[model samples]
Target: MAGTVSGFGRLNRKRSSNKEGKRKKAVYPEKSPTSPLASKLPRKQASSGLPLPEDDNEVPAIGSIYASPPIPSAPVSRLPARGFAGRGNCVDDTVADNALTASQHAPPDSGTVVRPLAGKPSNSFRDANKRPRSLSLDTAETPSKRKVTAFSEDAALVPTKIADAHAQVIADEWNEVARQSGVPEIAKITFINEIDHEPVPPDINTLFTYLDKDCLSSVEVPNPPKAETMPCIGRHPAFTDEGLFTFATDCKIIIECGQDCSAASNCKNRVTQLPRTIPIEIFKTVERGWAARSAVPLVRGQVLGLYTGLIISRTTASKLIGADAAYIFQLDMDEPQDADPSLVYSVDAFRSGNWTRYINHSCSPNTAIIPVARGSAHESLPYTLAFVATQDIVPLAELTLDYDPSEAKTFARKKYREKSRSKILKRKRNQTPCKCGTLQCRGWLPQM
Candidate 1:
């Protein structure tokens, strides 16, 4: 009875082993000959149990325990290992097989996240609370900062604006006159206010007449009895036989050939009495506020223009003191030294002036200012100021004059020490750097 029981146990074990083998064969059946891809796909080698290529272009077949389903025509987007519904933890044989197949054919950097092209769906998983990625077009580049200058800050001040407006009005008035005189529109004068000076009163003519009366009190001369009978130009010490005034002489008591004289209106000595016939313009400069320039070439000793403005007593000038002294011409007649200084007067062109008011100072000047008596009343005072070209002036050359001819001469004194002169010059508050750009520049403009 023991032998028969042992034999039966061995038979039951053998049956169980055979049943397992049959079940494996049923799950993985042989490839069907009628399949469309069966002939084209590479087959696995018997020795290595790996797929071998039939040709370089042949694709290897995927081995599976069961038959594979048809692949879709369009590529399916890859899904993240962690699904949106928390279903990633569940195992699915189809998804695992697809992932494994993709990994074998993918580029080496399989762990990198791939960005989707436009119009394509993105399969990337992201937290709902996080911000979305910004578009590249929205990014902006930063700009560099700029530096401010001293001149720009000073220009913004209120006083400068008011001065500029006043200058513009004056320029417009003169420009109209220039237009009437046949000056081309493009070559018109423009006044620019660079300094703050007292404005000349609107009733300038009345003020000038009164000041002229006071200045003429010292040497008021009566008209000669034979003035109308004979030619005054020939007899006057100021004029030559040709009726031209000698600019070189220091004729202390010369008078204008006025209505009392027999000379004609076109007398050569009467250049200042007529309107400006020369073409000129006022322009802005770097070193000076405004400067005069000749629109046409001028010969040496030619009368350029007249400097006209309100005549004021020296006492009145003292009260109205400021940087405007630069525009004031001291009416010191070429009279005897013993004469009373109280009778001295000055012409202030801070306002109510002509184009010559814009003329700037220079260490070596191209022009000279000469006092000419105009009208019978000006005989004693020499109130009329005339500018004459000391040298031939080219077109567009700036018209400049020595503010103090005596100071200009000091620059050439052999005995004068440069250091001492510089120290004395710098002591004055209004002294400015000379921008005459001449070879004999004295380094500083003469102060009044």
Candidate 2:
């Protein structure tokens, strides 16, 4: 019996020692259970829904669980105040009640009115609901293209005197030449003159005047002795009442006409026999300005005269007949634009002197001229002018043009007078007042 008791006491002491070691280990964080079976079993009590040891610092969930927090069923007045709407302490409750009522009336399964996704606009609203943008329209208006008179019917196609006389001369010449020779010499005299109803001033020479050597000597570039003996050509004609030629360069001077020389015998005779008495106006050129300072007059079947020591600027080179208008030509594009869309042309650039100048400006011109561009050999673009719309003009409409290349400037001073001594003679012959009744109408009176 003593041996049995002694053995039992020894076993108890070992058990107690094991329990003490376990208690000491548990004092620190206890090791997680290593047994798979133990891990599978759920804990009976937990802090924050986790094992007690792992979630020791977390809150407990006794009343917070199925019990719910003690929602103070104390009077609704016991709740806090709301910032918006200043409703009573039951504001949240009231909102919830109202929402419930609204939701009850709404379709079943309808979603709550959630705010739009961040950065996205609400689909419920329309642009009209936003503030109106105020805009001022004072500068929005623009002027219009000029409205000119159309051509007149039942008018003579050409000058009556020239047409009748030339017709007779052509018939007689054909009969005589054909009778004498196997082939008749077909002569087509290109008639070049003013087509507008305006009387060209008798004093203003229609032909261009070359600067005299004496006049040239007065300017910066002294003329050679050879140039002095040479005849002076007519002056560049001015289209605007401003009397300024836009193309006048620093190197060149513009001359005015002393007498009407559209169809004169010669340059010498055209100039009134006054001692260098013909009035001449000079103009200087500047850089970055338009080359065609003045709209050069052109006519159908007329020749252009190129003076020596003068070269067409690259910009205006294309405007020559068989040459594309440099200002408007663009070879890379399918179509070419006009250097000046406002001015109408009767022919493309070709070769002559006075005949080219005779082409007149028409307010309601009958002719529709086409200018073409021919590409250059070295350049991607060409130099050439193709005359289109030559057949469009009627018999008696006045040939006119917008003096300014800009459509706006031309339309502003849309009305212009066609003045000439011959126009007065025709007006008297026709026995009509010199009136077109345009808004910018130049009233009639004899050439005063």
Candidate 3:
């Protein structure tokens, strides 16, 4: 498209050194369906399989996202072979060029060049024989939210570090807060930042405990609530284990078989086994407190990590001390998702959980939690839920979740959506002030 614009010359000829009849490969980001600037978009035939993305903590069917097939497949044939369209197919000389264009181009009032021999057509006023000055990246935008079908093929595109003060700390020390973040060897978590005299976080090991995996034994420690608290974790203690879907009979066979689920190409168990492939960071914020972010550019459908925690029931959670009620995640839909059903299980991350605890809520979040079942088959609910990217995240863009995705939700969510829902109590405050800074801020976090 770039080489062959409406007013441009045909640029499709092969180079002298290129092998005869051989073509160079190109990878392009998918055309945004809602982009107003898109005049012509390459045809894309979306394929559907496990639509919810490859997440290790996901159940067989959690949610759906369209998957683009291999580039050599139907998707690639529709796009051009070469040339970046940054200047688009045609670079219009006369633009209502914004601030960036003005800084990089000669002014219209600056006047024309010296006369050449009689016949040549005059160049545009903005054009000159000399090269333009380099522009700042601030004026440029990253295609973080843009879709790309051929991620693996675009390995040559190296990601650059961004320097937004809000999105990232202005300056930082490359520090590791904890020795291990519970992520796999491939996935990494860097504890960073010390800008503006900010205090470095104390070792998390000194806080409560570090649990790489969920602890099922609620074995009443010398202290209270170290292991999962319950009659509680094993078997459904509730009168009825109604709406949850346990592993299928075949799924149970493999769980008992002890064979690595990877051996089977069609293994349904693989749905919840996809670990994170990107690196993440835990950074402190000014007004909002601690948060998490990706250390590099990330694709839209990638899963970041599991939201590991203690297994506690809604009945048990109701008895949680005061503000501690803010961290229980309702497990697989044991009850209708839309209704505030009194019965169900929840994953409590207050005392024991992983890096996901640091992820804050945003009105317009880039990440979301999807349901994911774990290795244990007998457990009535799924273990270790996951944080899936809702859109492509640029480097250092804060990772966020919508604590209250919809107002018509469950008790734990409504209760913990913020610290509280009403500020009328004791003439003090009830709900925590939301500082997500999105245009869609609901004025207050939905809390009860």
Candidate 4:
């Protein structure tokens, strides 16, 4: 029994010595299990069931986990009350509320300093230099301050004859007699020295009967009586009369009553000799350079204007080249078979002319050049040219004329030949793309 008791005492001593050695070797000061500081420290995490390192300094504070530390407030400096400027003495409540809200939500460890949103005042400083916006309603009340006035009775009653005076001055400045030896400034043309006379009408059907069917081959042709010797016609002639002007008949012979006639100046038969009263204007065209447009409505068969220019001999015109030759119009007149072609006259309007020079050519023309003779003297020469509207034209409509009547027949023949020659289409010779915007456009302008 004594030996057993001695053995038990020896075992207890060995265990106590081993525990003391472990406590001496520990790096951290040991704390009681029930101490407040021990409870506040973070619990140890194990690595494969082993206890964590014993370093109390490495543990985070319990308060830090639950909430961030309080931020230090900036010091406020007192300033003289007079430094407040236009903001008045009262503090703004909105600025205080925004600052408190930002402080309450900001993270403690964030490196960036917190700032209130735009338009909110910062609590760190008092900006006495800031001036409140001006409340003056200057712009809203400006118009009412303007002075108003009424015209004097005498000022309103004064005679307004300035416009009439100005017109008189312009008339004197452009007087025909003072300007170009009595040639009108507007027409830019001169007339023969003969007095204006009413024209006598002819029986339309029989007008061309004077020309023999073989006149082109005949050696001799009868001439009309002299204007000075012809008897007067009593009244003006009507152009609208059924047979007065028709394209069906040759209508080659054109005669007009002269100074000896007893008819009025407003005579319908005398239409071509009258001044160009129709409103017309010159304008730039998309395809063509310059074109003429009627500013007023025109009726079919109505005389639009006259084609006036330097009447040069055909031989002289042939010698000219370029733009000058391009604008020359040969007089299409019936001649004796033996008549000299060299003596035939042409009108060259390139250098000196009126608006008719700008009229472009179209396959389908709205106007036609008609033969017109003012007097017996004019009858012997190639008839004077008159532009007559071939179709009813609206205002602002372009005035076009067929430069050559035979061109259309030629085009039709070529088109028929192209369709029969092969499956592939062929372009016409000397053809240019037509921009006339007409439904019946032949796809090209006819070359002269």
What tens digits encode model 4's per-residue C-alpha lDDT throughout 1-448? 1111100000001011122121111111222212211112221111011122254212110000000011112111112111221233212334323322332211211232212111111111112112111212232121111111232333311111211122122223223212222222443211110111000000100111111000110111123335443222222232433212233222333445433344433334454544444545544454654567776787776666655444454445445443334455655343332334343445544333345655776767787665555454323333456666777799778898766544444556866547742232145433345566766455554433
Global lDDT scores for all candidate models: 0.38, 0.19, 0.35, 0.35
Quick one: best TM-score, which candidate? 1
* Residue-level error in angstroms, candidate 3, position 18: 65
Clashing pairs in 3: 56-272, 56-273, 56-274, 57-372
Clash counts per candidate, in order, are 0, 49, 4, 0
> Could you tell me how far off, in angstroms, the CA of residue 400 lies in candidate 1 after the best superposition?
0.3
lDDT of 3 by residue, 1-448 (tens): 1111111001111112212222221111222222211111111111112222254333332311111111111100001111112423212223212211222211111122211111121111122111112323464332232222333333313211121211121111111111122234445555453331112222221122323323332211111111122112233211112211222211101111002223233323332233344676667665565678887887655656656555443445445433244455554232233322222345555444556767776767777555433232232122345566767789889998766554313323655455544532323233455677987564444443
Q: How do the residues 67-164 of candidate 2 rate in per-residue lDDT, one tens digit apiece? A: 00111122111011122123232235464334223211111112213111111211110221121112112321112111113333323222222222
Error of 1 at 167 (Å): 7.9
Candidate 3, after superposition: displacement of residue 423 in Å? 13
TM-scores, all candidates, are 0.49, 0.20, 0.44, 0.44
For candidate 3, what is the TM-score?
Answer: 0.44
Among the numbered candidates, top lDDT falls to 1
Worst 10 residues of 4 by lDDT: 5-14
Error of 3 at 372 (Å): 1.5
Q: Mind giving the per-residue lDDT tens digits that candidate 1 earns over 84-157? A: 11323222445433533432211212232322111111111121002112212122111111112333554333
